[model samples]
Target chain A: MIEVIRSGLFTTIQDLGRFGFRSTGVPVSGPMDQTSAAFANELLQNDPNDPLIEMAYVGATFLFNKSATIAFAGAICEVKLNNEIVRDRSVLKIEAGSVISFGAMKEGNFLYLAILGGFKTDKLLGSACYYEAVNGMARMSKGMRLSFQADHQQREINLNRKVIGLNRNNGIIEVEKGPEFHLLSEEDAQVLTQTQFTISPQSNRMGILLNELVEIESKEIISSPVQAGTVQLTKGGQLIVLMRDAQTVGGYPRVLQLTEKSINQLVQTRFNMDFRFELARESA
Target chain B: MDNPTVRKYGSKAILIEWEAVISPEINDQVVKTAQFLQENHSDGILEVVNSYHSLLCFLKEKADLASYIDICRCLTIPISELNRTRQIWQVPTCYDTSFGSDLVSISNAKQLSIEEIVKLHSTGIFRIYGMGFLPGFLYLGGLNKQIHMPRKQVVKQAVPKGSVAIGGEQTGIYPQSSPGGWNIIGRTPIDLFNAELERPTPFSVGDSIQFVPISIEEYAQIETAAKNGRYQLKSVHND
Candidate 1:
């Protein structure tokens, strides 16, 4: 068991997400940076769908009551296991009663910590992902005890995976034309691919509001199914890129749909960071 | 001769758009397609979300595009043969002053008395057009024109669960407490979306609903029963 001593800005237990519930109007709330979370699980030799401690901006301090093997990944954060600085993206065997702390974030916004057999959190609707609507709690709080499998035999494998850090040079996000992409004028569409937009402060798991505004023709479609990575052009000319916890359906016109890889990259982006969009035609 | 257009929503989802406008025919097609996909292609399909005129099929695996398209084309079920099982749920609402703080305000805006407003709202048999914006939030159509009011300029931080609200040309019951802009006129005791139940949401798209007014004392009785899981929702099969 790991007890949260000091819950940081926003820390929650998440996996891939709750599936088979979108039809019932539930949002698929999961980790923002799935790529980084997956890497942590890979290093620990755990299932890809294992639950993880996803921290944003800051990270929580945990006291491991039971010794376990774990790994860390995503946005460079200063990690310390009982005063000894640890490296990211590598496996480490934590001793019982060891204090693990995370310092200030260095690169991106989201971080992940994966254990050998995954956290044994309560699964709601087939997912251990934390969604406030489903479980009534969105993030981990201090004094919360997270349970994990204590089978020491599971960590006997000789698994030493290479460290995979965030890609710093990739500033371009790829997207496909949305169903209502043709609603925008040619120049408006071109501006999306050409102009650089900064992430606004009013951003959460639902979506990120861009600082740059492109004048779009006012159009409202009948409420339709929308998903994560859907770029909606609001009537006020604001561009919103939906994130992991976005609504399943929306009334605004969906202008573009970001690629899955781009969504992973975009989730790690910090507030006020500038990025460009690259259009890739849907091959169907 | 009315075939829906299929397109890729993202890497792991396919969207079937029936038409731009909302109609009974379009809704029937949307619900039918969703049912067909859920019944036939439960293999790799993760979930199927349907709106007023569209259905999004989220797949669990990244299958080949050509093969998946072919599979989707083969699994088509005719609208005539589709499952038409639907229910008309009778939801009890308490429109008392304590439950509906905005009722008098909405009454004044619509130039009607509180009793008349409740009478008009309770008369309409609203159809569930979609389910979205939040979990189990049924987007129902058929709001009485006399009681139609725009959404509040400033959204409320949180409304209690089962608040029967009216926004623009639509009306719905809040499945769970959340931030909303709709003008709350009443509250219900029934659990529209209870996580403890096997099926969280009680209603689905294509279902019809009617609101029945109740006193605050009765609200307490029903609310207690609902909490205890003994409250039986009054619903009947619709032909």
Candidate 2:
């Protein structure tokens, strides 16, 4: 078992996501950075869908009740075991009674910490992902205890893998035309590709707000199904990139949809960072 | 009408748009398409989400978009052959002053007596256009013109669950407590959404709902039964 000494900004237990429930209006809540989350599990040779702690901005401090093998990935953060700083993307061994803490977040918006056999949490709606108060606890609070599988205890395991040769974090985010893309004025459409927009501070799991205002000529469509990576042009001319936890239906005019790879990169985009959007298929 | 315009939404999904307008016929077509896809799902298909006039198909991997487009273009919806059976639910609502905090203000705006407003609302049978945004929050259509009112100028930070509200031409019940701009006129005792149940929502898209007015005492009794998981929501089959 692990006890939370001090919870960070927004820490929650997440898995691959809550699936097969969107039909009933449930938002799919998962790790903001999918590649990073998967990396942590891959190091331990565990199921990628196993539950792990997802932290926004920075991580938390925890007390390990038993010796466990763990891994950390995403966001160049300072993770320390006791007073000694540990490395990222490598299997870590923590002794019983050891206090593990993550210090200042250097870059990116999310981080994932995974145990060897995954956290033992209640499987609600076929997933261990924590959503709002309806299914389970929303976020980690101080004095929270998380149990893990005790049987799969490996003493000495060497992992020499690292997240190498991936440049998805920075660059132009690729997107495709949405259902209502044709409704935008020619000039407004051109501006979307020509101009750069800053990521607003008012971003959450639901969506990321862009600083620039878009000039859309079309009105709101009827409330329709919207998914993660959908780029919506609001009535106030603001552009919002819906995240994993976004509502299933919305009324805003969808102008573009970020590719799956772009969404993975989007979660790492920090606030006030300026980025441009490029068509996924330039010919199309 | 011509077949739906199928276009790739992203690398993992495709959008099939049947119409730009909202009507029962359009919604039925969308539902039919969703059902057809579900029955004939290819290995790469993940899930199909149905909305008012379009269906979003999420795929596991990249499939032959050209072949899928051909399938969509040649596909024909046999309206008569489709299963038209639908469930009509009589949802109980309490319009008492204690439950309906915005009743007086809505009454003043519409210039109708509170009892008259409730009567008109109860008599009208509402159609479910969509079931989304929030869990079990039904997007309903069909409201009495007399009771049609704009949403609250100031949105409520938290409206209680089962709050029956009206926002312009739309009237719906808040399945769970949530921030809303709609004007609450009544409250229901039944739980529109319960995670424990295999089927979380009692109502689905394309279903019809009728509000039945009950007194405060009856509301309490039904609320208790609902909490105990013994409330049998009054429903009937409609073809």
Candidate 3:
């Protein structure tokens, strides 16, 4: 068992996502950065889709009541285990009564913490992903005890595996033409590809709003299906990118669809960060 | 109807869309195609979401976009044979001022008495066009033109769950408390969505719904019964 000493910012247990419920309008609330989550799980020799703790902006301080093998990824932060500083992207054997605390984040906005054998949580709709609407538990708070598998044998693994290519600061997000991309005039489309847009402070898991607006006369489409990574051009010329917890359907004109890797990259970027959308090659 | 255009929504989903219009005919095609795809395309397809004029098919893995588009184009299920079973749910609604805060304002805007608005809303059998925005939020069509009102200029931050509202040519029940701009006219006592249940919602796309107005006293009684899992929503087969 692990007790939350300090729940910083927003923290929740998430897997790949909840599936088989989009028809009923349930959003697939998963990790904002899937690559980091998978990397943390991979380091701990757990399933890539195993439920792990996801922290946004800040991370939580955990007190382990039992011995466990764990790994951390994403967001360069000062993580201390029992007052000893530790590095991320490497497996750590945690002893009972060990207290792991996270300091101020140095870079990125999201982090992933994975334990061996995964966390033992109730699954709603075949997913351990925490969605408040479905599971009724919001973010983790102080004094909350999280249950996990206790008796898993620790296995010997490579400790110094170098993880690379996760740097998302390039500000180049690749996108494809959405179904309603044709609605944009040639000049508007050119402006969209050429200009830089900053992430708005009003962004959340549901959608990411941009500080810049395009002057395009956008009309509402007949309410149609939308998903994560869909870039909607609203009537007010606001470019909103739907995130993990976005609604299943929307009425805004979906002008661009972000690549899967771009969704992971965009979520790691902080607010006010400028990014440009690049149209991917049609053949690629 | 002409063949619906099938295209890649993104890398992982395929969108089959009809003509850009909202009509019963278009909705029927959307529902039928969704049903056909859900039944036949199970290898890589995860699920299919049906809307008023399109079907978004989510794939388990990123499949060949061209092949999936070809498969969608090859769908030729006859409309008559592809008719899936549908139900007509009689939803218990309370139009009392306490439950519907905007009832008086909507009555004034439509230039109809409260009783007339309730009668007009209850008399029509609405068709479930789609479910979106919120979980189990049934987007219903077929509202009477007499009570058709535009959405509120400013959206309410918290429209109570089960608040039945009208927005332009559509009416729907808020399955959960959410920010909305629709003009609320009534509230339903029974829950349209329960996450604990194996089947979250009983109603589905292509199903029909009829609002049955009840008194405040009956509303309280039904609310209690529903909370205790004793209340069963009255529904019948739609022939």
Native contacts kept, each candidate: 0.81, 0.66, 0.79
lDDT for position B211 in model 1: 94
TM-score of each candidate? 0.96, 0.95, 0.96
lDDT of 3 by residue, B40-81 (tens): 778878999999999999887756767888889898897575
Highest-scoring model, lDDT: 3
Q: By DockQ, highest first, what's the ranking?
A: 3, 1, 2
**Minimal lDDT window, size 10, model 3 chain A:** A157-166
Cα error, candidate 1, residue B110 (Å): 1.5
Looking at candidate 2 chain B, the ten consecutive residues that score lowest on lDDT are: B72-81
Candidate 1, TM-score of its B chain: 0.94
Residue-by-residue lDDT tens digits, candidate 2, A1-284:
99999899889999998777787788778888888899888778789999999988878999999988888787767778897877534567788999999875677778888998999998777788877734847799999999999835654556555533233546588888888888877788888887888888788888989988876655879988899999998878899999978888889988888987888888888775778998766524
Model 3 C-alpha lDDT versus the unseen true structure: 0.87
Chain B TM-score, model 2, reads 0.93
DockQ of 1: 0.83
State in Å the error of residue B10, model 2. Answer: 2.1
Worst 10 residues of 2 chain A by lDDT: A160-169
Better of 1 and 3 by DockQ: 3
Output per-candidate TM-scores for chain A, rounded to 2 decimals: 0.94, 0.94, 0.94
Clashing pairs in 1: none
DockQ of each: 0.83, 0.70, 0.85
Candidate 3 DockQ vs. native? 0.85
